[model samples]
Target: MKTRIATAVLAAALLTACARDPQPASLPPAPSATSTATSTAVAEPCASVITRMSERERLAQLLVVGVDPADPDAAVRLVREQQVGGVFIGGNATALLRNNALDAVQHAARWGVSIAVDEEGGRVQRIDELDGTLPSARTMARTKTVDQVRAAGRERGAQLRARGVTVDFAPSLDVSSQPDDGPIGDRSFSSDPAVVRAYGLAFAAGLRDAGITPVFKHFPGHGHAEGDSHAGQVTTPALASLRTVDLVPYQDVAGFDGGAVMVGHLTVPGLTDGVPASLSPAAYRLLREDYHFTGPVLTDDLGAMKAITGTYRLPDAVLHALLAGADQALWSSGGNVSAVLDRLQQAVDSGELPATRVTDALGRILPAKHACG
Candidate 1:
């Protein structure tokens, strides 16, 4: 009986030892100071992927590519395959395209993607493919009071919201100092900077009223650039003159909560010795350090102009633009999307571009999105 008791005691001891030796625990690292605060925290895999990106992925995130809204696969590919952050809606102004556009936007959004469109009035309008397009900024500048412009903006924004577009690149703040400048002559609100400021603010307010966002473009002013920024290298001496005259409109929009500012691909000797504004750190500094414009900064289409296409490889230009200050690299063909991203990843891997800068820039873009929500 004592022998039996000894065996049972031994078994009991063994069970106690087993209970004391617990399996290894699996716990995540504690939140660190370097990590994003809980309030602005991004999703895990996405945030991790974004933070610990291979050069390929960083470039992909910087790009906002254009795609057909009708093709759900294209939109899904942009988000899932390419990991693109945004998609620019591209379709002719037609009933079919317009009718189907919103559905496409909803699909893209389901995958945590954002949608953008060029809803600038007149020749630049995209939403008008289904409804009637509004008159040019020049036409509006001639007859409209601030109230009238504001009212039109609200209505235009409503149309945009109904179509699933949240961002409108509008209110050409260029002063139209050069009457003969073909592309912007009709797009500018007025030759007077004060009038431009009033109209630009009203237009922005109108969009805000409808819970939509606006992107004011061609910073430091595109008014005096001698050629179309879309087609070729545009150079202008008035870039200096615009510091006070044409840029005044931007000064008014500068306080905009979530508005994005697009830098044009024009050469302004006063600001950038020879490099276009879109690729110039000096020009970007004027926005970031000098004026303290703390918002998402986008480059005018990297694929559109000869200035960009003729001089720098689209991928290299995209890297330079982001390194310089532009947050979102705009591209049209969607093909350049991958190449642009690859270059960015390469730059990050090479340590030529700091990851922190890219993160900060992307962070700036998020607020505008929140504003849209």
Candidate 2:
């Protein structure tokens, strides 16, 4: 045993000698002082508390649920009890003073949770009062200039960031191919995929510039769906055609750092039989492999889609979502809090959802927090 241990120690010493030093012993001869400074400075590591949160705390980082701003006590209870990874403020919460909302959200952030908002213009505006009046996405699209969209996005981002909103679920990338899509009609840029791609990229860049992370939403195209996803089933056409059109913008912006995606609840028969995109292995696979999307993936709302809720119970939805490759699950109703947590914990215990995956998501969750904080 001693001989073996001695051999192992000597081998470890040899490997250590071969490893490259993390901090350079000497600085590179540089073209300029600025270049040298830029090259030598490393990014600040994540906060130690965030890195070392308990299993429950880490799990909390995977949620972005709704809360009522009027009920401050209830809101605090939700945060303390639900172990939410984050809270997504809706119009109900947005109606409060921006500073008050910031105070509430930052309080959640202090416990290592993210604070997010919709803030998509047109019918989807949440923080319009804080961000100046928001223009409909259709109006921006009508300008036919990336600059128009970028400017609006930047301003919206700045305002939200000022209020401690870390994630802005904006720049609806779905191409409104079916002009009759009720919820997504003018909210979409245009029927033309190329135009949407250009505008979406510009908008995403603008949000990044304003120090807020943007989430590309309704992936695999909500444009082709015939019915609304809020109630019943909404199916789309072929995945091939949808990808080339509705998904083009998403593909274009997938490489942007700090840019994540929100998978809608709509089902595409061509992609995953009848499963909603949020729980579709097919959709997640496409996002991961085809689009090469390396950032986090979140559900639009687990409680909103019948395709999801009908097929799986709250806990089942949570388990299947993680299994299907979603990094986080959004629940709109506060009643589902315990169910969501129990489901996630059950998944972790069963080995169906590995702790490593949950931890990996926890790490990604932090960057968004730091970006917003």
Candidate 3:
């Protein structure tokens, strides 16, 4: 009986040892140092890719041309030929169209291109058919709390990101003092600069949290402007007025890290001798010097916007935008993209547009691309 007890005890000890030894399936293997290093090595290519890009390729990286969702083939062609840095999904963007366009563009380009959309919620939203609409900017400002606005931004960003969109041209910081203002009426968050500043920051933060980039629009204040830039040149209030009211929100968000600002087409007579801010060196100077914004500065659409096209053709307007310190010259109509590329390359070759300008633009752009990725 003692011998039998000893054998039973030994069996129990064996059972305990088995229980102490965890099954392989229960514990995930820790990543080895070599594997971790390999994963990091894979991500280092974008830097080298940027370094090896030719001058023309570098210039192309500054262009974010629009693409019609109906014409996916054309977008593919544009990516293959023009080597544009990004494509903004334009015109009635349904889920199918957005997915198709993304697939085509992503397949064509050797490097990934930033696929962006105007999903600013409310009336400015471009992909509402695929992603349901949120309240207008004015409505949200009047009714929604800062947290509510931020949550809306996250929802908007998730919808876009789900369809492979990376950038959101949104959260207009223009403070609409005049509710009846023709261009920015319903689009502006509030007449109060503080409200606008708070909501804008919240909305931007939400987009960043969702892994999407947000671009603040109509810099130096389009809220006070008289007319729509798409129709014709609009004029903003004097610089003093802008400083007090219009420029306040921008100054508040100027230090934003992962955000970009879109210079408007308004003719700021006070700051820039009646030059549209998008093409005016003085306007850009105010943003860069006074506001201390070092992030990417994009121009409002250069294509067919009477504010620019009325004065300069597509190619010339692109050149002016680049010369004026705009990083990405957006043509939202999907015009002859190759022609614009050819013209930019020619300008670079002729020394009309300095290569340093391209490099400077890339300095702002590539980091944003890497961040979004």
Candidate 4:
């Protein structure tokens, strides 16, 4: 048990490290069919709903705050007092996840709170103790055919769905052949771009088929990158290197029905200009304009990740992501909910994070969470 976990810890070191500035401003072909349905098409009642919300609530809605998983009441307090839009159960904090643990949190909210977890099988699962263990992404990819992989994903997604979880952060899209102990390692499906694409989409489809919102992560790509973002900033090959390899899987990303995206904090040469992608507008442009991904976009864990923390404070880090075009900023360490929200509120008033951006973000967020009540 120790060996498997330790191996996975090293293996899953950091499969999420791809966000750089941008190389070009060119727009890709028309977004895929599903891409057209992104929150940008939001209309009517939801817009009115946003107007009715308080500045604090509006800002809170864009946040997916991490919370203490041992104390169910802590989640309730966040929703009732701070009115946060979502609560994340990070690490192995399972005490609050049992027996409808999140029901109370939802009941306390006017909109609703999204309960999320890293049930990425292999190394990064939060429900292993409760749900039976599953193999890692690499193992499944090597042994299972695409159909079999989809079925496996469905089985696992069903287990997660039964536990009242709405989001599953899985099906890492990074392309890599780094050592099994490297940052991405076995967490990635394969080093070959085609194998990664077929099996990756199949697994994600399985999760979505089971009614779970799978989050395709670590864009523009983290595989083959240097180091782990958890320890410090990471760098990826130049944009030219990624054009043929890492970015291929994302070209057909419109296939991930009812899914979301998690950008990395990678420094790309022609793109991010040395800063992490999470805070770089150029990076967001690459995703939104180049990749044509209009779904709800989230930053990697800002509250805890060193790639982001070593520079900006939590509040500033989140603000930069929002200003840069990310719809939501996630911090899974779960502290200072009030302080973050206060900072966001101040930004809106001071014109740092304009009210229009807040509303534009909500157009994407409220629909994704079904929180427009």
Question: Using lDDT as the measure, which candidate wins?
Answer: 4
Off by over 4 Å in 3: 1-47, 93-101, 178-181, 371-373
The digit string of per-residue lDDT tens for model 4 on 25-116 reads 43222111222112365588798888788888889888888776667887788789988877777656577768987778888888877778
Candidates' lDDT values, in order?
0.66, 0.66, 0.73, 0.76
State how far residue 365 of model 1 sits from its true place (Å).
1.6
Candidate 2 stretches with Cα past 4 Å from truth are: 1-51, 92-97, 177-181, 371-373
For model 3 the TM-score comes to 0.84
Which prediction has more favorable lDDT, 2 or 4?
4
Q: Write the per-residue lDDT of candidate 1 for residues 246-289, one digit (tens) a residue.
A: 67787755577757788888788777767788887777778766
As for TM-score, the candidate ahead, 1 or 4, is: 4
lDDT: worst 10-residue window of model 1: 1-10
Residue pairs with clashing backbones, model 2? 60-85, 61-85
C-alpha RMSD (angstroms) for model 4: 7.3
List ranges where model 4 is wrong by over 4 Å.
Answer: 1-41
lDDT of the structure predicted as candidate 2: 0.66
